[model samples]
Target chain A: MLTIHCPCCGVTAEETEFHAHGEAHLKRFGPGSSEDEFEGYLFMRKNPKGVHFERWRHQYGCGKWFHVARCTMTLEVFGSYSAQTTEPPQEIMDIIHDRRPDTAAGPAR
Target chain B: MSDPVSALKNIFDDTGLVRVSEIGPIGMVTLRGDLSDKVLGKAAVAAGGVNLPEQGQCNTEGSQGIAWMSSDELLIMCPYADVHARLADLQEKLAGSHALAVNVSDARAVFDITGDHLREVIAKLAPVDMHPDQFNGTMFRRTRFAQVPAAFWMPDGRSARIVCFRSVAQYMFDLLKDAAMPGSEVRHYA
Candidate 1:
């Protein structure tokens, strides 16, 4: 089984520990943008041959969102980083924040 | 009065901060989103009562904490008394957002395992490293323990807290018990 080093988890884990999140660095469209703009953002992808950055989740391990740079054909991982700090679409950001941990301390009893 | 450590030991038969009783007070919450989203950081700080810890790390203050379960999901743990209400509040906050949050508090149970040689016992069951430099403090993971679905959090080098669904608690406990048994054929069990 292939082992990948998770930048966030800081260890080499079995491939089963993670899930591929697809190509990274997607383009963003402005509000009320044209259909072509939306289509480009939605349909365009760079299936690079080497050292392409992509998104991945530690599914069976540390459940954190992070990015990985790897070779498409060889599946050799070069590096990984947290998705929270990476650049993503604003719409995607809005959804992510909506699910963040609530800080209001519960009643002390 | 007794020594504080002894007193705590008496009150808390289990190790680690989260405890599991015969009838456990288990709380579980599932946080889902693309971590690449900045809003995920904001919402995680808002809903989890603490900023999501570093990748593979868990942060617990007072009675609550957050565990990184996967890139798109997290598991939150809190006291049994207030978990329901807290989950409801979190759901309401995410109501209109692009992300989705689900409360699975009733679906799982938690067990805290500490003391020396805990890592040795764990290594017997999982393929991950249990060394202090590799899997301590800033690490969390979901893997099979005793062949049951389980999640693990290491707050420090010497201790770990494990969680499993209630349906499989007995099976897991049996495995742990067997592993903990001394002088058994399994030389790895510590």
Candidate 2:
């Protein structure tokens, strides 16, 4: 099982202790946005095989939601950060770039 | 307004390798505030008569027990008789801070299980690593017990104090009994 380090609880718990909730840092397209933009926000998702970002709840650990940067292909977790922020921190972004230089510098649109 | 009743009248009297007992009419509150704020800790101690535990730890001073639920949260448990007064006192102490004190006594069920085979039974139900080397008295874990979410702490080698939402108390109790059967396999520490 995947061992996820829950920053809030300060525990590295097994996958059973967590619940993955899809993409992290999702940009919301609320009222007044174009239909296409709203549709994209609702149904569009990233299925990257390499470095991917995700939102996960440490449901059985801290009961807090957090973000994770991981490689879908190799299961190499880049790192975890708090869910309270709007975007991944610069240090985490730098680590991702250092490990997978091919990834773009900003959030994938 | 009505008098409270115990879910399990005498679970403590059971004879087996394990003994499970309901632990309240106790005061329970979920306390939230910035961990870095000294006033938050001070307020918690003021209400519960004990220092707030650090991450993954639990502390008991007198009838009050504080379990750290996360970096900025803790569960304060004390005698039910003192609940409302303690809540008011805590709110007063934390008036100027970014804090929330929620009374959860009615929403929770607390149970204590003691046995020589405590860890063995728990291994069957949850994915937690309860090897004596990895977990001990100072630690508490929020984890799923079988299919329901629960949290527990081993107060000693032979006992664990477990808490879960009241809705799932019966399910949790039955699951523990089934896992502690005489022929159940004792999980080896990895």
Candidate 3:
């Protein structure tokens, strides 16, 4: 099972104690956005095999939502971060780049 | 008024190494606010006569105790008779701050598990670090009991007090009973 460190509670909780909320850093496409943009915001997902980012809630711990960076294929967690921002912080992005340089140079999806 | 009956009054069991009992019709209030706010701390001391505990910590002074539920929230436990008055006092004391105190005496239930195998019984239900070195006494942890959400803290080495939603009181008690059954691997006293 996965062990996630909750940024808010400062505790490492088991996977069963946390709830995964799918992809993170999705830009909202509200009333003024185009239909395609709205659909992408709601339905489209990256589902990348290598590096991926996700949002998770420490449901049984602090009850606060946080972010996770991991690999889809190997189930390796790079790090955990706060979910208060619309994008992964620079340090987290840098870590991802350091681990997988090939994907770092390319545009972030 | 008739004495308030606890939900688990008749449910106490001494059949196993671990025995469980309901704590009380204890006065419980959930407080939410900025932990950095000095006024919130002031109000808590004025009302409960104790400081709001730090994260994961519990501060107990006589019959009053405060458990830090999270970075910005705390659970205050006091005598049942003092709840209403203390709640109003806290509200009045922190009137202008972005803080809230709500009575949750009936909304939740607290069960005290005391025995030689207390840690073992808890390890069976929750995926938490129950080791004395890793998780010490006076630390409050919010974790799941098997599948039900609960919070627990240890007052000393051999006992624990668990809190959960009132709706799951029966399920929680039964889970503890089964976990403390004879021949469990973690059962130490046997």
Candidate 4:
């Protein structure tokens, strides 16, 4: 089970208490937007074996949504941060880069 | 108006290893604000008769208590009869501030589970760490009690005060009883 640290409550809890909400940092397109963009926004996801960003809801704890960065291969959590931002915080990115220098800066395919 | 009835009607069970009692209807205020802010802290202390507890902590003086439910939420407990008055007082004190103080006594249920191996009984249910070193007095945990969301704090070494939604009181009561049943002891936290 993934151990998640909720940025809002600062509680490190098991994944059972949290609900995964698919990929994070999603930008929505609507109305006059092209069908491709809308379809990509709804269905396209970065299912990377390496580092990936996802959203999580602390369902049983504080009932707040947050972001989690982790590696799908090793199951190593990069870090968790607030959902109020558009991208992963610099600290988490820096840690990821520092830990895996050979890996690409972001999820690639 | 009509009489106030608790979800479990003060049901007590000692037939099992531990003592499980559906505590009487107690006053609970779901106070939401910036807990770190001095203004909110002062209002909480004033209304709850206790200082604002730290994260994952609860401070209780008899029936009056203030538990840190989250970074922005506090569960202030008072006597059931005094809930409305306390809530109004909290609201008046928090005027002009971004805050929410509402009485949640009727919507919630509380239980007192006491015994020598109470931790073992609770450890079987929640996903929380139930060891004494981690789940000691003053520590507050919001977790799934079997299936529904519930919170619990050790009032003392032998007893815990569990709070959950009133709608799940029956389910919570049964979960606790079954966990604390004779011969069903896991002896992990024992």
Candidate 5:
């Protein structure tokens, strides 16, 4: 069982304590946007085999949502962070890169 | 005002290793604000008669308490009869601020479990680290308890108080009774 830490509550508990919402840092396309842009925003998702950014809700704890950096292949978690920001914090990216040096450099999404 | 009734009408059971009681129609205010804001703490104490609790902490004095529920939320507890008055006072004090205080007493239920080896009963249902070394009276935890969301805190080493949605009061009570049933002691926290 995966153990996840909620950055908001600072509690590390079993993954059952959290709910995975999948993917993170999604940009919304509104009514004025092109049809393709809206469609892409609604249906397109990344299914990376390696480092991936995802959103997790601390459903049982603080009831706050946060971002998690995890490796899809090994299930190794890099870090959990605040969900208020548009991108993963620099330190989290640094940690992810440090562990998976072969992963492509992250740019602002 | 109509006569108040608790979720479970104040049920009590003592047949298990621990005694469980559905404590009351306890006054609860869901306060959302910036925890670090000085004004927020001042208003909370004024309304609840307790100081602001630190992260995952609970502070109580007399019939009132304040528990840190999240980074942006605190649950202020007071006597049931004083709920509306306290909430009004809290709102007046926090006017023009980015804060919200709502009465949640009727929408929630509270249970008090008292007996020896307090942590063991909670460990059976919650994923929290209930070991005595990691948990104590001053700490508060919100977790999944038997497939439902609940929050709990110890008033002392031998007693704990839990809060869950009113709709789940019966389920929570049943789960607590089963966990505290005789012959179920794991002795992990002993």
Candidate 6:
């Protein structure tokens, strides 16, 4: 029963309305690409054990696509933002710290 | 004869303002791929000039319509008469791409459900919150309607349209009939 924040609707919503798209920030090669290059792009994935950024779709709600940063081990969400935004929302980060006192020591930098 | 399409027609008449029209033989293709990929983007443009709409959104070009069913899936619709040739052209243009275009035209049927209470009727079936403001223009949905797999398109909230597999059309029609008749006893014997 996790409440995920939607950057499009600007509200936390039940997890059922959103779908987790694995690992964000993928790079694509141009046309007439080599076999190894294309294979690497398609088959590679990063299964990080700690804080990671992932894409998610607000499927049943606003239907907008966005990104979320969370700790993979604890499933503690740190922040969420629209795909177009360069930075995550500060308020969301603040709330994350407020709710999880132990993680409030400092930023994940 | 208790046919499903006819049953739908009967319900439409009883509902007063609503009218049901069959958009049969329409060519429907399901496209799946990464939205940000250039190859996928080119394939979408080659299919019809417009990229698939955002999830829950529909893009219409003349008689053709494409709805985004999920982040990586899109439903393509074109008039029955134009399907075969158009699909071939699209397939040729999208060759070698990491996308997959599946022909599902024969597997589905399209129904145009229009009139004032269409939204209310849909609320009785699907789990989506189909409110006027939240799900208006450009909004579409891939959800279950009366326990049938359906993809809905709302040109406007007042007039709702649904496309579903042909096999479940009868089940949906029966659900609509019972819904229209409130407390009436409409039993289905196996």
Model 1 lDDT tens row, B139-173: 67777775666877766666667777767766666
Q: Is the docking of candidate 6 incorrect, acceptable, medium or high quality?
A: incorrect
Tens digit per residue, CA lDDT, model 5, A1-109:
6778898889999899999998898889999999999997898888888888899999888989998988888998888999999988989989987998888745234
lDDT string for model 2 (B52-163, tens) is 7878898876568898888878899889888899999999889999899999988888788887778877888888878898888779888889888888987667788888
Q: How high a TM-score does candidate 5 get?
A: 0.93
- Better candidate number, 5 or 6, judged by lDDT: 5
| Rank list by DockQ | 5, 3, 4, 2, 1, 6
Question: Mind sharing the TM-score for model 1?
Answer: 0.59
List candidate 4 stretches off by more than 4 Å. A30-33, A98-101, A105-109
Instruction: Give the true-structure RMSD of model 3.
Output: 2.0
lDDT of 4 by residue, A1-109 (tens): 7899999887887899999999988888899999999999889987877888899999999889999999899988989999998888889999999988988756323
Q: What's candidate 4's DockQ score?
A: 0.75
lDDT of candidates 1 onward, in order: 0.63, 0.82, 0.84, 0.89, 0.90, 0.66
What are the per-residue Cα lDDT tens digits for candidate 5 across B113-171?
Answer: 99985688889999988878888869999998988999999888889999999999999
Best by lDDT: 5
Computed on C-alpha atoms, the DockQ of candidate 3 is 0.80
Q: State every prediction's TM-score relative to the real structure.
A: 0.59, 0.87, 0.94, 0.93, 0.93, 0.60
For model 3 the local lDDT of residue B88 reads 93
Model 4, span B4-101: residue lDDT tens: 98998999999997999999699999999888778888989998998778888999999999998887899999999989999998899899789999
- Badly placed stretches (over 4 Å) of model 6 are A1-109, B1-17, B20-22, B49-51, B182-190
lDDT of 6 at A85: 53
Superposition error at B179 for model 1 (Å) = 1.2
B27, model 3: CA deviation in Å? 0.8
